[model samples]
Target: MTAAILLQLVLNGLAMGIIYSLPALGISLIWNASGLFNFAQGDLLTLGGYVMLSLFGKAGLPYIPSFIMTVAVMGIIGYALSQAYFYPMLEHRVNPQIILIGTVAFSVFIRNLVLVIWGTTPQTYKNPFGSSVLQIGELYLMPHVIWIVAIVAVLLITLQYFLRGTMVGTAMRAVAQRPTASYLMGIRNDRMIALTFMLSTAIAAVSGVLISPIIPLTPSMGGIIAVKAMAAVLIGGLGSFSGALLGGVAVGIAETLFAAFVSSTYRDIFIFGVLVLFLLFRPGGIFRASVSEKV
Candidate 1:
């Protein structure tokens, strides 16, 4: 590949990877906080996109307001799911596998529900920023790509600050690292976990809205993105935010270069091939998660 095309592919992949990292980070958050993998996280993305489509596309709301509404709506849905289903089971010490199955069922329910309401045709919104390109030196970038990178950078910085600087963020981190201890310390574990659900889905909603501009809106799209994001999470190390970020960028760059150099149709095959190698050789990913159990 020529240097210029290679640079373009890298930039494109970086943006794509950053988007995938949003949901991957969510998965890691919930996993650390509750150890329950919400398979429906991706469907929440689909739900977010459709919600924004209705608000911004059809209802003529301002883009910023529509985006906020989409994230808030998704957060409420996630909080509801946790309070109504996941938390009760957690209180009773339900089987993790069964809880996992619950997530899968929820995933299927969402996909079908979206299908019934929005139908099968792919949809998209008008570009709020219009079609424009920005060139820096020899590299060219789209406005949306620049927006994605900037947003993700801001998000990561804010998250780092929130988790490290604020009491509530500290409590959430405590719960993630040590539920029993955090509960003993008057952390109100239920609320923390519920808040985690809200945060997770909110992040997913952001992913949905950011990606919607890049791709068509479809119920099935979330599943594909979910799989790829999950791969990102796994490759990045389960609970490390930096790991999730790195893993996603790695996957994105690898897949994009593979598509350009090898085969566009088999990009997924190449991605998974890389995943299998990681799974076999580096199962703990770039960073290993630490878990402590108190009896």
Candidate 2:
């Protein structure tokens, strides 16, 4: 109720929002560019966490090397998924619905794979930064929270520049707009899709590494976050970059506020309740843009 209490809650919400935005952005990118729902995108998050766990927790590798290694490995896995599964499906002219199902199966397989390799025990990701609090007047902030916001901001800005300024980024946008026309324009549609997967998965990996310290790590860890990210995609425009940004932060703040003022148990209910309202009234999302596709 007090101003300081409100500020702290808002800060906490912003941190959670940043965490959700990473995967949500990935989901939005893949959907717009490839025209396929990557049901396993969140599993990439879990995989990143476990990979970091092995590097940092088990091998005693330093944080910078471990984080870089995890992102690299996840990017490779993303490209492989496109090559092994998505490419094969396209080659055989498989139905899009079937490919979507394949993603679901892939999600299940990855979760079980983690469960088998890491066991059912919940592991903790050690924060590379020691617990340090910053105090301003009556408000206290965690250093990790500031790091999360700053890191996501840098990544998002870099992505915006890449998409708007780089040749490859513009080509990818062309593919998203019209794959057939992009092909006519000499764009390699398949390669662009593969690159989209690689980039999106790398983003998911970054999210995993950043948030792992705050949450308990288990095979099931990515599931809830994945669901929330999906809702974020819906709330933000499905294909709008700025929409995803706005939707993620909005959802995070709404959920935190609801939990503070209402029941913690109803936090999810409130979040999804807003999602349903959006679905009914403004399915185009907070942004009113549509993904253009050639017929």
For all predictions, the C-alpha RMSD in Å is: 1.9, 1.8
Query: In candidate 1, what are the lDDT values of residues 88-164, reduced to their tens digit?
Result: 99989988889999999999999999999989999998988667788887877788888889887988899889888
- Global lDDT for candidate 2? 0.86
TM-score of 2: 0.95
TM-score of 1: 0.96
- Summarize candidate 2's per-residue lDDT along 48-67 as a digit string, tens digits: 88999999889999998999
User: What lDDT score goes with residue 73 in model 1?
Assistant: 94
Show the colliding residue pairs in model 2: none
Whole-model lDDT values for every prediction: 0.87, 0.86
